[model samples]
Target: MLNDMSENQAGYAFAWNTPKSAINPYLDPPDPVQKSALREVIALYAADNRRHQKPGESLRNAVWDRYFFNADRDPVLREIAQDKLTGQARMARERQRFNPEQTVMDDIHAQPAWIARPLLQRIAFLKNLSRPGPCQRYLCATVRPCLDRLTRVRDDQTGPSIRQMAGHPGLEGLLVLSDMNQNQVKRLSALVAAHMAGRLESACSLLPLDNDVQPEAIRRVWEQLAAEVMRLEVIPPAFEQLKRKRHRRRPVSYDRIPGSLARMICTTWWYRRLWQRRCEWREEQLRAVCLVSRKTSPYISREMALYKREQRRKSLEFFRAHELINEHGDRLEMEAVVRASTSHPVRRRNEMMACLKGLELIAEMRGDRAIFYTLTCPSRFHATLSHGQPNPMWAGTTVRQSSEYLVGVFAAFRKAMHKAGLRWYGIRVAEPHHDGTVHWHLLCFMPPGDCSAITALLRRFAIKEDRQELGKVTEPRFKANAIDSRKGTPTGYIAKYISKNIDGRGLGKHISKETGTSLRDSAEHVTSWASLHRIQQFRFFGIPGRQAWRELRLLAGQVNRQHNGRKAGAPVLADRRLDAVLAAADAGCFATYISRQGGVLVPRRQYLVRTAYELSDVQNKYGDRSRRIYGIWSPLTKERICTHSFKWKRVRKTSGGQISPGRGHLFTPWTRGNNCPHGEKINAHHRIRVQRKEEETIKDFKNEHK
Candidate 1:
């Protein structure tokens, strides 16, 4: 009679044999008490089939269609159904329900009464873990290309920029790629940050631990990442990462105290690296979330227009100081220019012409000093250049090849400036036209020299190297005149070029007004730019960059010795500044400011907010040589090797430049009158005083002197 049984609702039908429990003991399933509601539902459906009639058949997935989805349905009508094959059959059925991209582990919290978590964890973990790590295709094919379009690094610190975060063990989240429709690129970037902050618990909660194997696998990969972070502990603080094996060891600590000094250097290195990594991760986060891009008409800067109006000689003086030029018209060497570019060699000279003003801003900010000069007073020079207009011949060229070619142009331009005696601090950012050809915007610091002469030099050299190497400058290239930066102008000047080549201003803005191809579509139209081009988009030169790491290292050591142990083999406290910065963190987000009042019981506001880098000690080094160190981060060695040197060791005073050793001279980025080295209460540029030094060295020195 069951042979005539009709099909169940979902078009599924099964013939059931006479009750299997009554005939075959080997076919018996577990007792009803052990069966879950889900299982019971299956058992009842099978019994329904058996009573209906066909022999040697059982109820199929139609039961789930009937009961698992409809909570009102009850399945325990009779106890005659016992199918041992139910488990495998149910799994197979579940697998068929979702698309291949989804996993059964996704519904862990959805059905607590149906399947206990332990059972779910066991079964789901095994199945997903056995699956290969998330598809690498989305990482390479979709996300990377998009990132290459979006991320552009300005050369400031040695930390990894958003562009370089890829391939870091901290960024393994890219492995668990979701479909394109899911907007997984943003999630992948966040996951990388999560790993960097060591937020394992947060990661565990946000991602599916049992089903999506890739996230779990990504966490495991970073054990090696932690090892790399730990390995940097050997490098001295302040110095860039070791880019290559140095031919001979350059002592990071030149101290004579030996073991005590070595311990200090090692400890400082560890804290510094930790801070560097943290800062870099923070910068990456900033770029990922806050970087603003716009597609308004070409930037209109009155400062740039003013720069164009200057006489040729006047414009030349902006980059090369008038005092340094020779009577014979020979330009000062690169060293003089580099020195002059670094805050004009003395506090007396304040006019920083061109985009070079940003260099000072970079220095003061990097040294953890407060930014007193508003973006309003910026005196900078901006210029734009194009390689060729709508050239189809270079359409297929990759970003790497184009970057190499640009390097040649850069070298030629640098040589021309060196020959012509121009030392400018500026940034060069390349933007691709809709056609995929490249154009460059340079924010430079050109003195009040002959604007015509400066323009001539740029025009002459822009194509010089390309002509030299390729044996022909067949393509036409155009160089725009340099413009000076001013109020509201310098702020928008180079920043526009350096920002992501995006379309809409940002999320909350008037996106409807945005015209032209979108930033994303533009990104997709071009070949992978960042993946192939390793060069920084913006560059700085001859600017007061960093306090010599050597100086900072000594300070860190001194602080450690005093707080912990001054004797050899004795334990020392971690860096006080780093401790403050770390302690200032609320949750995983690092503090943008810290109190400076020192043990003062004032409100947090009274403590005075200071920047991340500024949270460190800077006082007492008031007049010291805050030389700029240039370098690159090596992924292979995980080191940032310092490349600049003291070629003019004799020309520049070397040792006495050490900031007077004791108190009343501590200079932080926030320290006022930082430019005026004179201890006399003098120039308005001089900030009055810094918070008293945390060290007792001043009193000791005074006592010893007396």
Candidate 2:
């Protein structure tokens, strides 16, 4: 409008000379204050157009747009402006009018679109959060408070129980906590809080045991009262100890009179009095000897020596007449010596019985002069010397070979004594190796009449075996062969052999440094490159060194040539190659079975075989009857071939659609007593894929339907 008015009035306005800066256009248009402010702004702009307008005319455009409604406007621009203006007005009203207090209650009474949409959604979310039901929800609300107060409920207090008759008022759905006091309510609150915090069971476990109540009632209380919450009750360790303690009868009373006179005469001081009397008798014998020596002097001493000699000779003749002494003058001692031995630790019951039994045996058989000894175990020696010396023995086998051989030798001697029907003795096997041969130094106990028979048996077994071995034994000497050569020097030759087999396999390449390079520096440099290559281009299967790789490739070429022998075609899976396949199958089958049983299955390492000969080699390597290498991809060469065969097929095809599953021959039971005796279970055996009866019936049903 301003532009159009100005164009018509341009000539007249020039005559009137209305200087645009002096006459303000807005002065007559609106409120006086707005008009005056608008004129002031216009006057500032008119004073210097250059000063008001920015170098890019940005400020001038902005000023005109804000102040003027007159527009030579683009339709798009005008429409955009109108929309912005309406939006601003609406927003302003909304911002000024909103109140939460009014909306919250108003929404309940008459839900607007937004409110109505979320009610069902909110219920669903809350219900999911609530879980199980509202009773759990309500119980959840009170549990914490109830638990806090539970501690204060007297230990004798009857804990809560739900008492509802079947088909009665509380039957279907109701929570009635019987015998719940205010304190229990507080405890319940604590319990609920714990439950909310995911410690409900733990909190219940923290409850004091109702020791004051009946044991049965206390047991029932946890099951019943704790039904609404999780609870753990700890049994006292003292109770556990008591349960494990051994039960034994009390010692028989010596103070009380017995029915039998023999038992009645038993008294605590009897042994003490008897020991004193024995000591007195020994003293008297010494006094009498001293008195006799003083009176007879040198004459009595000479006579006594003669008499002792004569008595010894007579005793020897008596033993000889009875065949107690052998022709070699070795005689069987009436009482045998005791020596250290080893045995398994006695169980508690055995130990008690042995103690009583040993005392009885000692009293009946052992004389006063005989010394009795119990064995000390090697285990005890091991414990004592653990920190000090290492055993010189192998240490078990070294000691055993020597000790056991001696024990066997002496055992033969003892057996001879026993065979003679003489139960009157002890024989001990002695320690130490004898003349480089393990032989027992026997101390035998035998009756005077049985000595000759025992000696003869001992001589026959030992001497006969000894003579045969001695006849063959020769002086020790080293035999030299064609061993000292470039190929067989001790260390160098060992290195050659070691490098070829498993002994050298894991040692990797024995790459040496070049003439001018230090081994370490060369290794470091080579290692860096190898590591980079390993990360970048390396694949599983080949040995580490370049030479190993060449050998592998050569081996692979050889396999390929052999495979080509049968004409080029798809390679057959070999035993070694099928390992990964079988492993995958086993793993998958196990995983599926476990999954069905509500467990998880972790997949095994590889899923396929890249080389057939590899499987064949593995089957051959195991050497188990269950595993036969029938075509496997080789790990080294990556060629497939059948290196072996199985007597039975692993998997078979049936007339039915179902493929019979393979049994893993790889896993056989490993235990004694026929636990897993043969390859029957380990090796796969074919069974009918489907029951014939069922299959026939199904076929008949299908035909009938048709």
Candidate 3:
């Protein structure tokens, strides 16, 4: 029948109409249990395909084709079908042992959505529903309440038996809780709870052999506690280290630990705090163990650093020798062009300073008050104390996690301000703490009357977590200072931070307060930290965006080129507002540009000029169409001006007096004169002719002398 039908019809018939016994006679017919499991699997497969399917595609057909028609050809699909059939067969056998009226099939069908989820997700859901043991019940009654107050996770969400939660992939390898008794589970639960509550000392006290816990059990519990509380993804080096030294009964001391284990412990708050009490660590030791160690930071490795350095070297070499040639025969050397672009560190720093100064000037003219605020993450996010000691309150949070926390707080603060109808403008600089936690320095300008309200809202969000630890003073978490012009300018206040995070220029011999190192020496580490965490270092809000500013600058350059060295007036822009913005950007006056485009309070849609983008002819590396900014569009004038009129390509330069062995041709070296309207082919031909004439003259001279 299949041979008589077309391929599509055969596929459809085999997928929908054919029975399992028909396909393979030895295979038994699917019972209700197996059929239900198959349906669930097919339903999930269809849902997943629906997410990625095109508009007119049928998910039903796609699922059938994938599971039935293609199963024989595709190993993955065949394995999945076999696994579902085998698992359902086994489950059907187990269902026979239970009541015939209420089988596992009924339960599976009752929550098909839950059954369709991944194994780990299902485990997490079941773990949450599982009843708590005695120790977990105690923690839920005491420790969980405090944690609930501090974290977004509610008490109900954190519901116990933590032994069941051990099903997490990260914890599965560290502990074998399946064989443990009630006493062991109670002890492990209590220890994890104590560590979570910043009570590592109390947890350690419970680890003594006198508590009726086996030495091996204590070791496993400690490892599990460290892994879970610190949120470590991999088995800690301490586990293997302790295994190698199984002869010892007590837990290892900090000084006697391996560097990898030491780094892990020092990077976590409670563990670091416990170690500090046991041993006095010097600043150098702390730096060596925490800052310099790469064991914990996987995003940046020695290989990656070497790769980046090599790439930088090649980029510099390429930029130094090559010239970018446009379709109009216009050429610009790549090095000079790149240095002027925003990606350059020095250029970016200068632009940021100019933007800040511009905002300050505008604020002064409008009678707005300048307020400098330092927003920090809660104590739980910090890894170390200010004096280079481990913070007892640190919860083993990573730099990326802390950065995200600050971003969330700032977002909330912005939302609150928006609701309150307050307008502000300024720059925010994110820099890492000494221990690699990120904090933000925001220089904001707001009306004098609204300053207090804004500060209050920010303080409320910044200290929302671990508020009790903040005590009576919240300055350590959220600090606000009115920029007093009598002492120094607002630009001066933030300049050091900006330079310290960037190139650290003009900061002669100044030391960083956080790291206690020379600002110049520590700047590289700060930059690496930011890069490793993928954090945005600087952001400007309540101003015309940087893209529009850059485009305007390009337009101004175009206008300058149009009338360069001529005795004619400069070309006029399409609109008066456009002309003003172009002039301001040309003059490097960010304040004027901001005002002409739209003041700090105006929305993006209301801006006089905006960036215009077009879909590219080529797809990106991911095989998706990407948009490229090509020109500027003026909303007021209803005109679009294409600033990028010519496409440019980088060409390698040939050195002077160089001859290729294959062709015996003398190459013309690239020079400013040769880059003019004179074509490169003409120059090369002329140079070849001159060289040939010289060679003939030399031959004649040699013959006459002979």
Put down candidate 3 lDDT per residue, 313-407, tens digits, no spaces.
Answer: 88899788665655544556568667756777898889889988899899988899989999888887664456433455655455667888888
Off by over 4 Å in 2: 1-397, 427-429, 434-439, 464-466, 470-706
Candidate 2 C-alpha lDDT tens digits along 470-578: 3543211111122233443222322222222111232344533212323332322222222211211111110111122222222333334333344443332234433
lDDT of 3 at 403: 82
TM accuracy, model 1:
0.26
- As for TM-score, the candidate ahead, 2 or 3, is 3
Each candidate: what lDDT?
0.33, 0.30, 0.59
Q: What are the per-model C-alpha RMSD values against the true structure?
A: 25.6, 46.5, 28.8
- State candidate 2's TM-score: 0.13
For lDDT, the strongest prediction is: 3
Task: Name the 10 consecutive residues with the lowest summed lDDT in model 1.
Answer: 373-382
Model 3 lDDT vs. the true structure?
A: 0.59
Ranking of candidates on TM-score, top first: 3, 1, 2
Q: Candidate 1's residue-wise lDDT over 1-706, tens digit each?
A: 4444443322444335322336565786755677589988998999998777644333445566576654334344222232335665677677745432233233333423212233343344545654544333322332233233222221222234332443666554322221111234444434443444453343335555577456234433333333333333323222232222366466332221222222222323334333334333322222221111122112211211222335333645543422122112222232334443333313111222222343435423433211111010000111111211111122223323445666676677778777877555444556543222245666554444534566567666655433443344323454453333344444355433333432212222222122243443333222232212233434444432223212222223333332343344332213344333323321111112112112211233333222212212221222223323332222222333222211111111215533234531232332111111111121112122223243444334223222
Give TM per candidate.
0.26, 0.13, 0.52
